[model samples]
Target: MKNQFDQKWLDEVAVVALGCSLPGSYPSREALLDAAIGAIEAGDLKVVGRSSWWASAAWPDPTAPAYRNGVVLVETPLPASEILARLHRIETHFGRVRIDSNAPRTLDLDLIAQGRTVTEVGLVLPHPRAHERLFVMGPLAEISPEWRHPVSGRTAADLAAAATVGSDAAPDIAKT
Candidate 1:
């Protein structure tokens, strides 16, 4: 499903920043935002747009605390490897410890998509596993519902549709 699209998007659109908030040892949103902004600034991540929303009550991991996540649109001149490396640096700055795949985090900065470029060396464009994650799709839909998967040629709506938990379960994750 990823071969139909043109590669022009890569040269034009290099990076899109997506934000996720989690139960962290950090003090508050201001601190988290500062950490994120600092990373973007140091790595020269252009802030095209940004928005925040509390986590609904679905609570995927019953043992984990709720999260308030957001999305950011960015354009980076660096390649995926460099960008990912920079993102990790920012994550480290925020005290993001990788305990497990869905472990609670202080701040998770995911590289949702990098134009139409797709690779498996380390980073996957259009996020290889994006089709199955509601956490990523919900905030993304807010940013660009029509944003097409660069490689798969699938719309954000498609990925949202494929999410296992119905819309009913999402509100549970968003905090009021």
Candidate 2:
């Protein structure tokens, strides 16, 4: 029996912004990123574009290992729920465990947005907290500066700029 979330829709396109990070000891950033790309490819998601890694903002713990963050843009026909499910599966594939709300892990994949869709039950499109996180906005701005918040109508770059104010975490783009 196929999972309900696995059911496919036809010709739907979603502009997905994914924020990826790895905390604690694990595979090299390059390796983990490669794995993510591989997983997206295997899932038949079209790679629209991606941004270079950036230093992650310290949240919940400022002393944790520096995290490398980046965003990927994909065109997928999957529903918002299934897209989120796929993201969780990718996280699990990279050894993520749900120990706590913001615990460090080998991989963290967030589904930042699914076009204009929005829901708070199982998954939230345009991510409920995305507008306030530099980690999400920075890379997202790099690739999709014009991308607007569904609710606030603020562009990704605008959100990123606003988030930088008074932020102790100075995120720098990773040199590839």
User: Which of the numbered candidates is closest to the native, going by highest lDDT?
Assistant: 2
lDDT of 1 by residue, 1-176 (tens): 01122335433454343344453555764357556765686656776545444353334565555555555556777777777788888788777888876666776777777776656586667666666666566655555666677776776657767776424324223332
TM-score of predicted structure 2: 0.80
Q: Among all windows of ten consecutive residues in candidate 1, which has the lowest summed lDDT?
A: 1-10
The CA root-mean-square deviation of candidate 2, after full C-alpha superposition on the true structure, stands at 7.4
What is the TM-score (0 to 1) of candidate 1? 0.74
How many pairs collide in each candidate, listed in order? 14, 0
- Give lDDT for model 2: 0.64
Q: Whose TM-score is greatest here?
A: 2
Instruction: Give the per-residue lDDT of model 2 (tens digit) for 51-156.
Output: 6666654566767656666677667766778877887898787778898876666777777776666554866666677788777777767766777777788877
Go through the candidates in order and give each one's C-alpha lDDT.
Answer: 0.59, 0.64
- TM for every model, in the order presented, reads 0.74, 0.80
